[model samples]
Target: MNEIVRIDNLSFRYMQGLDNALEKVNLGFEKGAVIGITGPAGAGKSTLLSCINGVIPHYMNGDLQGHVLVNNQEVANLTFGQLAPIVGTVFQDVDFQTVSITVEEEVAFGPENIAIDPAEIENRIIHALESTHITTLRRRAISTLSGGQKQRVAIAAVLSTLPDLLLLDEPTSELDPIGTQEVFEAIFELNKTLGMTVIIVSQKVENLIDCDRIIVLSDGKVAFDGQPRKVFMRSQRLAEVGIAIPEVTAFIIALHKKLGQPISTERLPLSIGEAQTTLENILRQYGVLS
Candidate 1:
């Protein structure tokens, strides 16, 4: 997979800050991968997202150091107008992004601003609504939608621009369990079927466990970057940094600590089904279960 994003020795300090919000952060994201960024509050997760979309130095007042490259183009050098088509961002607050009264208008807003051909704009809106599973809601008013539906519309709005990389900040922060699942299902489907690279900034560990990669940030730096299975294993360190481990992994860790079962690290269980299967196999081996 080609590298879609690259952050090299990146650091930034806001106008009122004494220290950098992001400190010497070095990382790269692969194309067509769903990557999760999570950490405690003040971990610079949002700052990292801003850099990818060329907002750090261009739109926001900040002291920036090092570089951020999207699709091999340096962020600092790209104008917001130039970057808009390359990177699409959905902020944490869905309400803040809601501009149009109707879902169809909302989804078409971005593409229209870019002066895309009228025929192409129509196609983009249709594809975006379908991709985010919001086709039925297109004729409805945005204010009448549920929290999850609003989020889906926000994502669809960004998707209409046909950006190569999508960056979301706490998309499900205000959603219920079912609502969260619906939004994530749409996101993962896009990544899997459409080959769109997605980077989501969230605090929900369970929601991120199945991503192709999970990056844990601390004190404005990357403390862990790898597959979800490996990152979840550092329960102690993650807890110290104020990042909670996924419940399933936490339960398995406790079992290993208490029983000395020597659980294999090859494929640590991240979900209930995986945990159940692993536990049953272990019990069977010990003659405790058939």
Candidate 2:
């Protein structure tokens, strides 16, 4: 598959820093894929997303090397306004995202800013709300919505611009369980159904279990980059880098050690239902259950 976003030998340092915030970080992302980025604090995760949005070398001066490409266009060469149509970045705080008083007005803001035709803007508003599963919240006051609803509103606002790529930094960090679930559901719909490419930066590993790929950064370098199961399989290495495996995966790993079963790492569970099935099979094998 062609890479929608590609980084090659990318290294950078803020003007005041001695070390690069990102070092030799070569990576690629596919269209319509949900890619998760996670790592310890100060691992340069946020810095990476900033590059794509033309924040580095523009507003923030830095020594840099190599390059980043979004939609095959060199990111550094593009101005922020130039990149706005191609990329949309949503931050963790919904408060910063909500400019309009109501959901419909907020969703319409992106397209309106670009001076989209009036009828077209209306259609985009409708599509964005429906895609995010927030059509019912369309006329509701932004202040009246829950945190999860507000987050979805932020996403819908970005979606109205019809950007080629979506960057979410800690989109669900401040959310409760239900809020988190709601955001992921919208993410899945955008990727799985609407074929939108999304990259999420978050430390919450459990929420990323369903992602197509996960990349772990450490000290400005890639420590792990693979599908969730394989990366989480090396729980010890992850822990060394101050990253944690999902709770269910950790449980299965511990169970294998305690039972001396020598289970395959790939057999470890990522979800609770998978854990249940795996546990039952182990019980049967041990004659502990019929």
Write one digit per residue (lDDT tens) for candidate 1, span 74-150: 99898999888878999877897788999999999999988899899999989888867779998999989988889
Write the residue-wise lDDT of candidate 2 on 1-290 in tens digits: 77889989999999998889999889989988899999999999989988877788777888888989988889888877788888888876779767999999999888888878999999999988886678999999999988777888898899898777889988877677876787688777777766879999999899889998999999999999999988998999899999999888889889989988776857879999999999999899889999
* lDDT, candidates in the order shown: 0.88, 0.87
Query: Model 1, poorest ten-residue lDDT window?
Result: 258-267
Runs in model 2 deviating more than 4 A are 95-102, 130-149
Q: Where in model 1 is the C-alpha error above 4 Å?
A: none
| Candidate 1 lDDT score relative to the true structure | 0.88
Among these predictions, the greatest lDDT belongs to 1
State the TM-score for model 1: 0.93
Best candidate (score: TM-score): 1
RMSD of 1: 1.8
CA error at residue 132 for candidate 2, angstroms: 4.4
